[model samples]
Target: MARKVLTVLLPLLLCVIAFAGLLLLSIPIRNVREPPSYKYGIVLDAGSSHTSMFVYKWIEEKENGTGIVSQHSMCDVHGGGISSYAENPSEAAESLVECLNQALKDVPKKRHPITPLYLGATAGMRLLNLTNPAASASVLSSVNEMLSKYPFDFRGARILSGQDEGVLGWVTANYLLENFIKYGWAGEWFRPKRGTVGAMDLGGASTQITFETASQTEDPANEVRLQLYGKSYRVYTHSFLCYGRDQMLKKLLAGVLQRHSTHPCWPVGYSAKVFLKDVYSSPCTSAQRPPDYDVSAEVTLSGSGNPILCQQLVSDLFNFSSCSFSQCSFNDVFQPPLSGNFIAFSAFYYTMDFLQKVMKLPVTSTAELRTAAKALCNESWEKLLELAPSQKSRLADYCASATFVHQLLVQGYRFDEHTFPRIAFQKKAGDTSIGWALGYMLNLTNMIPAGQMHFHKGTDHATWAVLLLIFIMIILISLVMIFCFARSSKTQSAI
Candidate 1:
C-alpha cells in the first residue's frame, strides 16, 4: 500500500516543481534582459531666421504612440538662415554639414543606416519660391544632394505649407502632454475634451495660429483633419505670411521712415542703412508689389527712442476692417473666440523672456509689458547692450520686438488681459522646446496611425494571460494523471 502511494505521489510532486520553475523563469526573463533597442530620427527646421536640427529617439518596437518619442539633442546651424544663401544655394546645403556631423556624434553609428533625415523649409523658403523660383529649386536641390551623402535614410527635403506648420505645431504640443495616451481616443472609455492647448508660433518670417474649435468650419482651407492613436481631430489653423515680427518690423519701418529718418522703435545711438528692396520684398506690404525704388537704394535710419510712436507705427500694419468670416484676426483671416490656453513660443517667448529678465515684469500684465518696452526703448544703446549681452546682435530690435509682441497679441490676436495670462510664454516644455519640429517628425513617422491603437498594455496583458493558462493546464494534467494511477493501483490490489 505504501509503495503504491509513493508511485502516484512522485509524478504529482515533480509537476509541482516544474510549474514553480516556470514561474521563476518568467521572473528572470522579465528582469534580466535589457530594454528593447531605440530607433532614431532627424528633422531639420530650415526657417527664415535660422536652421535647427533635432535628433529624436524612440523604442524600436513601440514607436507608434505618445510618450515614446522625445528630442535627443538639437543643433543650430551657426549662421543666417538657409534662405539667406539663396544667391549661393550650394552653401545652404554645406551649412548643414556641421549639424549633421553633430547628429552622427549624438546617435550611435549602428543607427546611421536606418535613421531617417528630413528637411522642411518654412515661410522663408516659401518666399524664396515665390520671389525667385530658380533660386528656391537650387536651394532644395542643394540640401537634397547634401543629405544623400549621409548614412541616414534621406527623406525628401521640401517646403512645408504654412497651414501644415500650424497643425503640426498643435500636434506636438498635445502629444508631448501625453493627451492621446492618457484619456485615450481609441479605448473603450473615449472621453474627448478640448484638452489640447493651442499653438502660436511667431517665427521670423511667419506666424501661425492653430486650435480646436467646436463650431463648424465654413472654409475647407482653414480646416485640418488629423488622426492619431485611432482618434480624429478637426483643427483650425492659419499661417499669416509676412506677419512674423521680423517681416512686420520691416513693413512698419518702411511706412514710418523716409530716406533719412529718426526711427522711434530703435534705441538712442543706433542707426542702420535699411535697404528699400529688403522692406519691399514681402507680399505683406500694402502695395502688394515691390515699391518703385532703386534696387540699390538704401535709407539711413536713426533712433529717437520713442515707444508711443513705435506702437502707433506698428499698429498701422494690422488692418481690422475686412472680415470675410464671422470674426477675423487681421488681413481677413478667420479666428473664432479664443477658448483654450495657448503655448506661445519662438520669437514670442524670446522677446517676452528678454523683457521679463531686463524689466522684471510679470508676463501676465499687458500694462507692465508696454511700460517695460517703453523704458527699454528710451534707454541708451549702451545700457541696452549691458542688460542683454547675449542678444547683442538683436539688441537694436528688442524695443520694437517687445512692442510688436504687445500689439500683435492685444490688438492683432485680440487676446484680452485676462486671456493674455493663459498664453504661456515658454521656450520649452520640460526639456523639449515648444516648436513645430517634433510634431513634424511625428506626422511623417505615422507614430499616430490612422485607425488602430497600438498599445503596450494589450500586448503585455495577452502575454501574461497565455503564460498563466499554460501553467494551469500543466497543474491540472498532473492531477488527473495522478488520480488515474491511484485508481489503477486500488483495482489491481483488489484483484
Candidate 2:
C-alpha cells in the first residue's frame, strides 16, 4: 500500500520540481536588456481662441545622473477653441480626430498599438459661469463621449483654470527660451541690466501675467510668485468675462447708442461689434474688400486729425475698458474716483516718455518719450522691410551702418523691437494706462523660475524598459528552479 501511494505521488512531485528547474534555467537567459517602445501620442492645448493638437514621438537622451530623458517632436492640427466644440461636441471631435487620423497616415501600422492621445482645455470652458453651465458641461461631456468611442489609446482630458493657463504659457515660452534662444534679457528687447522679467499673455476671454526674477538663480524653484492683484482678483489671471474683441465692440457700441439719442460719430444704428465680427469672421480677407474699416480708420480717428473728438472717443472706450475689472471703483473719467482709463493712458505715455526722453534707452531720443515712441514705430516698419526675403541680399547691402535700432530709439517709439512687436508695443507703449499697467503688474507678480515647472509627467522609455526586463528575469528564475526540483523528486522516488 505504502509503495503504491509513493509511486502515484511521485509523478506529481516530479512535475512541480521540473517547473521550478525550468524557471531557474529561464531566469539568466531571459532577454533583460531590450525594452519596448511606446508609440507616438497626441497632445491638445485647447484655448479660448484656438485649439492646437500635436502628435509627438518620444526621443530619449541620456544624462550622467538622470539616466534617460525623453522629449517630443510634434505634428500639429490647427482649429478653433472649446467654443466651437460647445456648439457641437461630436462634430468638433470628429474634425479633430480626422486631423489626427490624417497625421498618422505616414506612420506605419506596426507602430499604432502603443500610441496615446491626451486632451487639455483651457480659458474658454473654464470661464463658463452659472449662466452658461449647461452649455459648458454639454461641450465637455460631448468631447469626452466622442473621444471614448475612438479605438486609439487615450490618456484623458482636463480643463485648466485661467492661472493654470498662464503657467502653461510661461512654461512653454521658457522651454522655447531654453531650447531655442538660450539667453536671457530685460524687457521685450535686450537691455544692459537683467531686471525682473514679465510675461503678459492676452487670450480671447482672459489674460495672464507671470513675473520672475530676471537673473538665473542657484535654486530654480525659488523664482516665481503667483498671486492675484486685488481682493476680488484671482491671481495673475484676470479673465474679463465676455470682454473679447467681439464682445467689447458690442458693449462699446451698445453703450454709445444708449448714451447718445442719435448716432454720435458714425451713421445711426451702426453696430461696430456686429459689423466687425461679420467682416472678421467671414472667409474674405481685407485685401479682397473695399478697405473702408481698416486700422487706417482707427489711426486717422486717434491721431492728429480730430484730437478732441478722438480723445472723447478714446476716453469713452477707456471707461468701458475699465468696467471689465471688478476691482476698479472709479466712475467719471478723470473725476472723483480716477478712471482706469486715465491711469492706463498716463502711465503708458509717461513710461514711453521716460524711456525715450529721460533714460535715452536708445541714446538717440535724448530720453524724450514721444520721440522714442515714434522711433520705435519707425524701427518696426524698417524691420518689417528687412524681413522680406525677396529683398534680403540687396537690403543687407543697403542696410549699411544706419542703426535702425537707434533710429527707433530716437523716435520715442516702443514698437518693432521684438518678434511680436505689436504685442510688445501694446504692453510697453501702454504701460502707463491703468488697464495695461495692471496687466503688466499682474504679469510681473506671477513670474516663476526655470525648472520649477513641468510640461510632461510620465516615466521615460528607458525606466519603463528596465522595469519590464527585471520583471521577466524574476519569472524565468522561478521556472528554472522548479525544473531542477522536479528531477530530484523523481530520483528520490526511484530509490
Candidate 3:
C-alpha cells in the first residue's frame, strides 16, 4: 500500500514540475505591447527677463521599448519675474497656470495623471536678496502656495546660481549640437564636419560662453571641457550683476548726471531716484520696449569714456598684454588713445561686424541686437510691451560692438586692443526653444540614452552586450519562480 502511494505521489510531483517548466517557458512569449496611455512632461525655463514653460509627450516602441518623443505645440507659459509675482503671487501663478492649462485642452483627460511638471529658475531668481530672513521666508511661502494650485505634480523647482545656469546652458547647447544638428534631421539639411564648437549665450541678465573640444575620432563618448563666467571673480563665468543692458544704463545715467552739475534735470541725486522709481513703479514699461534707447546710449558712452586709460590700467594690472590681446593677429582698432566712449562704441561695432561680416550668423542683424544695449532696461519695460506687436529699431552701438567682437575673433585680433576676447557665434538650424525642450525631455525619458551617456571609461559595444546578456538571464530566473508557484498543485488548489 505504501509503495503504491509513493509511486502515485512521485509521478504526480514530476507532472507538476513539468507543467511549471512549460509555464516558465511561456512567460517570455506573452504579449509585449506599448502602454495604452502616453506620459507627458513640462519644463519651466525661468530666466531673468522672462519665464517660459514647454510641454512634451513621450513615445514608446512596441518592439524594443524605445522610440522618439515629440513636444506638443503651443504649450508654452511665459510671465514676469519672481519680484513681479511677489506683490501678488496668486495672480502671477494664475497667469502662468492658465497658459499651461490651455495647452492641455487638446490632450485627453486620462493622460493628465501621467504628466509631470518641473520648474527651474536661472540668473534672475538667483540674484534675489534672500539673506533678509523675513523677506526670504515670505518669498518662499508665496512661491510654494502659488505652485500648490497647479494641475500637474511638480517634481522639483529651484533657483540655480549663475554659474550653474552657465554650465547647464553649455550642456544644453552641446546636446543640441550633437543630437539635433549632427545626427538627426539637421544632418539632412546641412552637413558640416562636427568638431570642437564654442557657444556664446547672451541672456537678459547675463552672458555665458562655453568652449568644447570634440574628439578627433568618431567616438560618441568624448570628454567635454567647460568654462563658465559670472558676476564675481568666477572667471570660469562672468556675471555682471546688474550689468545687463537696463541696469547698466541706469547706472550710466546716474553717473553722468552726478558728474555734470550743469545738467538740465532735477536737483542733486533727484534724477537718479526719480528714474529708478519710474523704472520700478511705472506700468508703461515692457520687456519688448525696454528703456529709452537714446538715453541709454548717451549714458554708456559717457560712463566708459577713456578706453585707452582703461586698457592701460587693465594691462598694467594683469601684466600680460600678449596673453590678453596683443598676440592676436587682428588690429586693435577698438583700443584706447580713443576716448572711452569711442572704445565702448567701437566694441559694439566690432561685435556686430564680427557676427554679421565674419561668422555670418543669421539673426545677428535682427532689430533686437541692433538696438541700444539698454533699450529694455527694467521689469516695467517688459510688462508694457507684453502684448504689443514687434517693432524693429537699430541700436548702432550694441550691433557695432557685437560685430566688432566677431571680426576680432575671425581676424585673430590681438587682446591689447580690447579688454575681452572676440569669440565666434555658430548658429545651427532648428535651434528654437522647442527643440531644446524636446531634447531635454527625450534625455529625461531615456529615449536617447546615447545623447546623455558619458563615455568616460572604455566601455564599448562588447561591454554593453555582456551587460544585456546578464540582464536577460536575471529576468529569465525571475520568470521561472513566478511560473513554478503558479503551476504547483497545492498552490493552485489554495487559489
Candidate 4:
C-alpha cells in the first residue's frame, strides 16, 4: 500500500511542478490595453487688450508620463479684456458668451461635462485690481457666474500674479521647444541636450523676462523654482507693469508733450489728436501730468521722424541707475544674468515682424534693426500705406514700437548685438500660442490629474487560450486522480 501511494504521489508532484513552470512562462510581463479616451481642457487668456479662449486636448494615459497637450482650436473674444468693462461688470460676462459658445461647438458635447475650464486675467486685471478693487471683484464674480452656467467644469476666474505670469510664460516657451522633456530619436524620452530657452513676452500693458539661472540670486522674490515632467528648474523672472506697447506709447506721448511741442517718436507723415486726459489717464503717466493742466484739453501730435529722439524717449521709460544690487536690469530689479536663447512673442513678434516686412530683409542684429526702424520712421506716411495698405492702422506705430523694443532689449536688459541674434521673434510655437495659459493648465496637472488611459501588457490571445486550456486540464486531472486513489485505497482495505 505504501509503495502504491509513493508511486502515485511522485507522479502527481512532478505533474504539479510542470504545470507551475508552464504558468510562469505563459504569464505576461506587463499590463497592456488600449487607451481609455481623449481628454479636454480649456483656458481663457484675459489679457490687457483682448480676451482669447484656447481649447486643448490630450489622451488619458501615456507611456512616458502625462499626455502631451496640444491646442485644438482658438477663438478671440470680440471685445476688450474683462477689465475694460469695469463700469458695467455684467457686460464683461456677456462678452465671453460668443467665444464660449464657439468653444462649445469646437469641443465635442460628451466631453463638456468633464472638460476643465479656467480663466486667468493678465496685467489688465492686475491694473484694474490696483485702481478699482471693487470693480475688479465684480468683474471676476460676473465671469465666474457666467462660466458656471456652461457645461464645462468651471474652475475659477482670477488675476494671475506678475511673477506667476512671467514664470509660466517661460515654462510654455520651453515646453514648446521640447526643452523640458525631449523625445529621443531612438523612441525614448530624455532631457534636452542644449538646455532650456529663455522667454520674452510683451503684452499691451506689461512685458515679462524670464530665464534659467544658476548664480545665487540677490533677491529671492525675483527667483522662481519650478518642476515639471520630473525635472526641476531655477529661473529668474520679472514683469514690468506699464512697460507694454500701449502704455509705453502713452508715456512717450506724455513725455513729448511735457518737453517739446513736436513729437519726434512718431513716424513721418503720421499725426494724431488726443485729449490730455487720454495721454495721462492711467497711473503710468499720471505723474507726468501738469499740476494745473486741463484734462479735456485737446493736444495734437505730429511725427518728426527722428530715430535718435525716438530711441532717447524710449530709453527714458526705465531708470537704469537705481539698482541696489550688484547687477540689475533697469528699475532696480535684480537679475542674475540673462542666460540661453530667448523666444520673444506677443508685441515683440509684431514689432520685429513689422520691421522685417517693411525692410524686406531679416533683422538679425541690433544695428540692422536700428537701420530698418530709421528707414521706416523716415518714410512718409503715404509710402507706408502703399507698402502695407492693409496695415495702415498699425503703420503709424511701427517706428516707435521698434525703437522701444530696441531700447528695452539693448539698454534695459543689457542684451548686446551677439545676444540679440539669439532672440527668435515668434507669435506661436507650432500651432500653440506661446503664453501663460497653456503653462497654467500643464502645471495644474501636477495637482489635479488629467483624465488618464487604462493600459495593460499581457500575452497574445492565442497564448491566453493555450494557457487557459492547460490550466483547466491540470485541475481536472488532479481531481480525477485524487478520487481514483481514494476509491482504490478503500477497495484494497476492504478486501
**Per-prediction TM-score to the true structure, in the order listed:** 0.83, 0.42, 0.49, 0.82
* Candidate 3: stretches off by over 4 Å: 1-38, 62-70, 74-79, 106-108, 130-137, 179-193, 213-240, 260-274, 278-389, 392-431, 434-495
| Per-residue lDDT of candidate 1, residues 257-298 (tens digit) | 542268888888988888877777665564644456676788
Model 3 lDDT tens row, 312-424: 22222112234333232312211111111111121233344434453334333233332321122111212323322241121222322332233322232222324232333
Per-model CA lDDT versus the true structure: 0.81, 0.38, 0.39, 0.82
What's the residue-level lDDT of 405 in candidate 3?
34
Rank by TM-score (best first): 1, 4, 3, 2
Q: Which stretches of candidate 2 lie over 4 Å from their true place?
A: 1-41, 61-80, 85-87, 106-113, 179-197, 213-246, 259-495
Candidate 4 Cα deviation (angstroms), residue 366: 1.6
lDDT of 2 by residue, 1-495 (tens): 786556555655655565565444333232346754434555665656666555544322211111111223333346667655655766656656655665467334666555556667755666553336777777777777766665556666767655555554543333222321222221011212222233444445444444343333233322334421111111122233333333333343444333443223232112222244333322212222344554323211111222233224323433323433223312211111111111111122333433444334542223333343333323322452444445433222111111222222222122222321222322222111112212221232232222222222133446545655665565566556556667767898999
Which is the leading candidate under lDDT?
Answer: 4
C-alpha displacement of 61 in model 4, angstroms?
1.9
Per-residue lDDT tens digits for candidate 4, residues 1-495, read: 688878578658756865785666455443356535667889999998899999988866552343467899999999888888999999999999998999899898998998999999999899889988999999999999999999999999879988999998998888778776654433334566678989999998999999999888999989887766566678998999999898898898889997877788666777889799878767788779788989889978888888788778888888998999999989898888777889999999988888787658567998887787777777788788888988877777778898888888888888887888899999999999999988898776552233332223355556666776777677668768777888987998899
Between candidates 1 and 3, the one scoring higher on lDDT is 1
Better of 2 and 3 by lDDT: 3
RMSD of every prediction: 7.5, 19.4, 17.5, 11.6
